[model samples]
Target: MKKNIVVTGGTGRFGNHLKSISTKHKLFFPTKNQFNILNFNSMLKYFNKTKPDIVIHLAGFSRPMELHEKDINKSINLNIIGTANVTMACSQKNIKLIYFSTNYVYPGINGNYNEDDPLKPFNNYAWSKLGGECSVKLYKNSLILRVCMTEKPFIHKKAFANVKTSFMYHDEVAKILFKLLNKQGIINIGGKAQYIYNFAKKENKKVKKIYQNKNMKIKVPFDSTINIKKLQKIVKVKF
Candidate 1:
């Protein structure tokens, strides 16, 4: 079945990879002019005109984790309020929604956090993402993906050896996305649990291993790996 799908934030890093994938469904990567998530009228107008079957809400504030701390208003408005607006539009139009969340929603102390596990966002950015999750959770036709994926080729020169996480490349996750389109509810999406350096070294052999020492400015999660058994059972996806 070739369904009409609308993807927000089509210009972002992961969105770019998702756009390149070969899927059976019809994907619409709308520019901000066509669909501005922060504005309810614009989102609703676009939804009414396009009449898409699925809305993948990817437009939100992310990266430079410091930005969230430095400017809380930007974080709350973009990630939280923007997502709520998308959810409202999707709910009104009776469209299926797939939200892109983060694995940082889980407590960093314990590894292998499940979907039902208690959520304790380790950073302000995670808090904003969780706030977005709250709105989508209310919509029955929504699917929340707590993904722990990163950019390909390992852009960073220094990798955290002491910090462990389930890091999958953008393309790997994009490949398995179409399979999960019809699914609803929360799901942990990630790769096998491993140290950051181990995953980075696979692509960049010269990547330096650096532990989060006392001098480190930012707070990095020690262990934020999620339990992806449910995702494996659902899609049989391999990273």
Candidate 2:
């Protein structure tokens, strides 16, 4: 059955792909001016107008992981507080909420993390995302997807050979998202777990190899791969 779906941050990288794939539902991608997550009144006002059945909460701070450190306040306000506002608005209307979180919430030391696994955010960026997760967890009618996805064409020239992760392209994940809308709680969403170099080389053979070393300013996870067995059971697609 078709339903009304509102996507926050619909203009963003992942949102842009999601908008392209979501044809079955009455989707609304509200701009910041139209539906600001930071302002509950704005969110509520938009929700009241759209009367959506579900809200895909994707509005948050991401990228250039260092930004989280440089501006902790911005990170907290946008990612944590902004998500909290969204969650509250969704809860008030009893709308199903789907949150896009990151796989970095899990301890990178061990790969193959499941929904039940203990969380240990690798960096401040991950911590802020996890903070958002706290509010979503409180809402019963919600789904949290700890996704590990990247843009197509592999933006980085040098890929880490040792660091392992379940990196799926944004377009790939977007194709499978609608199938998991009814899912509740947390689910690990990504492609086959492999070395960053291998994942990159598949798309760009010319991609150079690099290593994660102590000299690096950012804390790179050695192994942040997620187990998608639960996800496989939900969707027909194999990833």
Candidate 3:
């Protein structure tokens, strides 16, 4: 019998891709309205009924990075508190949990940060994700993916030419996820580190090049590329 896998943010950009590739495992993606992460009882009830072997917790606030800065409460409630609720519910039921994290958790000024490197988040989004990471660590049966994924074809008209990162398409990340579903602990999931504009130009030649200044309103990570050598050896391919 196929094991059941439940994705918390089934309607999210990344979750949608996870749902598409879930063949070996039966996938269950519940919408935010139906499965509110803020409500612990709601998640507990569902966990009791489905009893999923693995829960990919994807529901969280992201994008428009300014939103996290302006609304501290929302960021705390969704990414931090919501993750706590999920962690508590999963811990009680003894279910495996996979937490989606970001490379921004590391200092963006440097490159090639390993999974064990110290974290110095440059923005609120990273802080919120780190908040979630703290909870996942408390639970022994959990995995945290410090993902460096971007939308395919680059969504920006002007990309930062000077900035470096390990960016992967959402589809690519989704394809690689299942191969490591059973693995526990933290893993850096991304492609080789390179200029952001160069990575985007491959799929979008017309994308303009621009530089971001530190004085800007939004705090951006300059070079948050992660070291995925361990992951490469496990997957046996460049991602």
lDDT, candidate 3, equals 0.88
Regions of model 1 farther than 4 Å from truth: 214-218
TM-score of each: 0.97, 0.97, 0.95
Provide the global lDDT of candidate 1 against the true structure.
0.92
Q: What is the lDDT of residue 218 in candidate 3?
A: 41
Write the number of the candidate with greater TM-score, choosing between 1 and 3. 1
Candidate 1 lDDT over 1-239, as tens digits, reads 99999999998888899888988888988899889988889888888888899998899999899899999999999999999999999989999999999999999887999999999999999999999999999999999999999998999999999899999999988887888999999999999899999999989999999889756664878999999999999777665
Q: How does candidate 1 fare on TM-score?
A: 0.97
Report clash pairs, candidate 3: none
Error of 3 at 13 (Å): 1.0
Give residue 234's error in model 2 in angstroms.
1.2
Local lDDT at 142 for model 1: 94
Per-model tally of clashing residue pairs: 0, 0, 0
